[model samples]
Target chain A: MEREIRIDPVTRVEGHGKITLHLDKKGDVRDARFHVTELRGFEEFCVGRTVWEMPALTARICGICPVSHILASARAGDAILAVRVPDAAHLLRRLMNLGQLVQSHALSFFYLSAPDLFLGWASDPAKRNVLGLAEARGDLTRKGIRLRAFGQETIERLGGKRIHPAWAVPGGVSRPLGRADRDWIASQVPEALDTIRTTLRLFKETFSTAEECTVLGDFPSLYVGLVTDDGAWEHYGGVLRVVDAKGKPLVDGLDPARYEDVIGEAAEPWSYLKFPFYRPLGYPKGMYRVGPLGRLNVCDRFGTPEADAELEEFRARGSGRSGRVFDYHYARLIEILASLEQMKTVLEDERLLTPRVRAEAGINAEVGVGVHEAPRGTLIHHYWVDPNGVVTAANLIVSTGHNNLAMNRSILEIARRTIKDGAFDEGILNRIEGGIRAFDPCLSCSVHALGRLPLEVEVVGPEGAVVQTLVRD
Target chain B: MDLVIGIGNLLRRDDGIGPRVAEALRVSPSVSACAVCELVPELVLRLRDARRVLFVDADARGTDVRLGRVRDEGSRWGHTLGPEGLLELAARAFGSAPDAWVLSVPGFDFGYGEGLSDRAEGFVPQAVERASRWLSEGQVSADGA
Candidate 1:
């Protein structure tokens, strides 16, 4: 007899997600669903506040990725004032952004997803977390902790605090980095560089499974990201560009204020998160991706030397005329390296430690847009302010919102492949969740729609005994 | 020396009301002089030195109290150890844990939405009042002579 199995309120990962799988009479394949459960009203809340308060208020949306919110908000704030921040300010902001990327990527690899990869996917559920990984590989775990700590320290030194620092303000940072902080950041660069090398080596040695390499590779997606005028991935400030599967630019030199004309969010009754797509393309066709995968596919070259080497290797493995989805997974490590290298470049700059960090901007209430590359993906913050500086309207499109379509497609692909396995097991369902986990969607930042997101699953059974009983949350 | 502990996931809507209130108390005109440590559950070890303790957290009682309204806890409270858990964990690590009472705010929603519900918003002042009273009473007599 076969049934369905369901787990709601999936723990460990931030926010909530539900996993459901249906089994046939012989307990074989049926169907599966990975539905995110949560609704965020950040956009609505942004309606009445002042633009000045947005950088700090919006940053509170997610504790794990506040830097993204901070930098993104600061960028949007800059647009409204029509003031170009100092060069030192731009460099310092980039350094902090890199710090965020390093820490967040390290967390995703070592803390959240590593347990499944390192301890065998089928291992006991109890011992399949960071703690379990530590018990098995204490030295590696220690190194991971130190690496994350160093990244966070870099952020704190530059931004002034670990979680939500008030450093990246509208004009620039609140205060310039003093010599002590700059020297402190400089001293840690060598160790930081070493950690990046060690992490890449660890990923290479411990991971690199044939299944990982082949599973979601070669799939096509419309990729969008920010790149500097010199063709390097830009985290601080750059013109937005969209590239199709063949690595051909579809749109370039996009201004943030005009995003409403390019991007539009659609609602699906089955999920809480909204799926954002290129408005001109319509629903399914409009589906696009943003994040590490999208960023890698969209960029012509990485800015840093070490990252450029990894990017070259990534291109070699892609058999497609353009980049493949396979490159997206590989690019994860390369981007982390890029982030680290970028961190070093910013820390080594002497102008970053100047005494005057904050700049004065005359009050000019107008519409503004801010976009920055978050660890998860590209984030945009758009606001409309009155002459008094009070926010009149706000709209935010987060990285997870951008990746919703791709995630759904990936989940179904994984489900169709494993749902019919003869032995009938939960491994297939877990793998589907694992596949989605690679994207690291931030549901807290995505879920904001009216109405329920419907989910359905069917299970067949010969005698209808207890095999699997699952329900979507 | 006893301890006062506040625990809540600040990101979860009204669940964070406790910490917000505690933060307000940390700077309140009444309790400004007292040194109180705020912590999450994982870092409860910092409370080991206190003899008497006060714990604040959000609670759901099915009905009655308004959202955000702070209650002194009923006689037949069925809730788990609020401050007691921290003390217990501390005792396990060291030797002894302190005694404490939990101040609970009736919660409406702990969803991912922003801003506390009106019910929860209304209880902020009441929570502050209870904390002031508890602080004025102190953990216990300071007499060691």
Candidate 2:
């Protein structure tokens, strides 16, 4: 009498995925699995390519977060060269990463997930989208669009193109900031700051009382992200930090090059994405969360004044324990504020206008590992190259991969609370999707094998027979 | 000024038509042309300053290459906004939306890889000719002829 429920092609997320819930004869949820169906084989194909081409080649992995890959790959190249990037180039890289954070987080909160937060979850599926949000709240929609544009414009100004710009090179960036570009970016900061502030106020007022905030992926889990030496929230360069669910620092200031010693990837048969876990604890038991929630939890404070104040208020929301996955939305908003503040500071720095942007060097090392915080979470790129600088082996631990284990657990937790006696209603189904969306997992970035699997849901009986099938094309 | 934007991934087989057409049309001095991999919301700001805008892309729904005016439509997701969505954003955010058109090239092969399919490549010249005609006609109309 046991039955299975599947939700295929989880909508409103970056890439394709599904959730399968196993039920007992009593119809209570027994287990849940989150499946990533497609694979790109980036790691395999990247081998034998010249290390110099990594920034540009890997940038093509995902159109959405190519900047993250470009920067991370370039950092790896810098490691291979064994040369420090100039100070101005470092600051410029930080600016570009902040722009990425702003655009990406805005896209997640406003475009992808806002409909469920603003419009009722059970509302018409047709009306539950960015267009619907625009129809109902035009002002908010406009602000979201403009905020995203501000981020994209910043990238375009610095990197030369909106999507894949090969500005970040091995030793440093390709060019320094021009006066016009710096002034234009400086001019846009005030409005960008205003938009984020307004968004934060509105989001807090609306969702603070919602029941979804408490039950949707609210369980405690370990948190991981990068932080500056003084423990400031950092996106570009920092030492890796891991904190337990209780806000205690389990490990801090670990060298990113030594990431293999601290973390390991575990593969599951049903999923192409690898489940990355803390090395000592082993497998599922070492499960930790990343992205906005992890970054905020792992960092001690935001260095800027306004962001630090916002961070204090954000922390007080959970009474100092802000591990709830639902809080990721708020964490994204706070990070946006911090990014804007950091951008303002960086743009005003005169050193960025210096002509010296890159450091020339030949490959000095055979192995290199680069780590940085992508919009999703901590991303590490490891490469082994020959003396000729051709890649021998490549491994990428994308942010979504690190959150794979936690994403599965979250889906199960939400399903247990929402589904009733094997009922697969639309509302319950959406709640399950909402849980996954809360993490904003990018399957395209995580899975690097080979498959073009369609999104499907199969209802299986206790005897392992397919009772029903649902396909989303 | 008038703008022509060709949008699609150059890495995807037939999807590179948009950029291909844009590249071919770059010789025309009457309008500005560029190729982008995707149509993002940030395009609205760039469109706001233009007198007219044309977006070119490969479409599986089309049987033949066609050109038509852009219309405002509801969007289901955030990232997949098309020409119409960008126009709508322009109108909503800037209070003025430019005249916009979408030049859709019918494409059969959209699989992973570079270069256009033979069928899609056959239509490239015609697509370029049609886009050029539109630009020339627009120039004549704008000149008060």
Using DockQ as the measure, the top candidate is 2
What are the lDDT scores of the predictions, listed in order?
0.68, 0.86
Model 1: per-residue Cα lDDT over A350-411, one tens digit each: 77776666666855658888988998888988888888677887778888889887877776
Question: Compared with the true structure, what per-residue lDDT tens digits does model 2 show for residues B1-145?
Answer: 7888999888889999999998898544447888988876667767877888888899887888788777555543444777776776667656778888888899999899999999999999989998888887754232112
Binned by DockQ into CAPRI classes (incorrect, acceptable, medium, high), candidate 1 is: incorrect
Q: How badly does each model clash, as a count of residue pairs?
A: 27, 0
Q: Write the per-residue lDDT of candidate 2 for residues A73-169, one digit (tens) a residue.
A: 9999999999988999999999999999999999998888898989877888877877677778878888898899889889999999888898898
Docking class of 2: acceptable
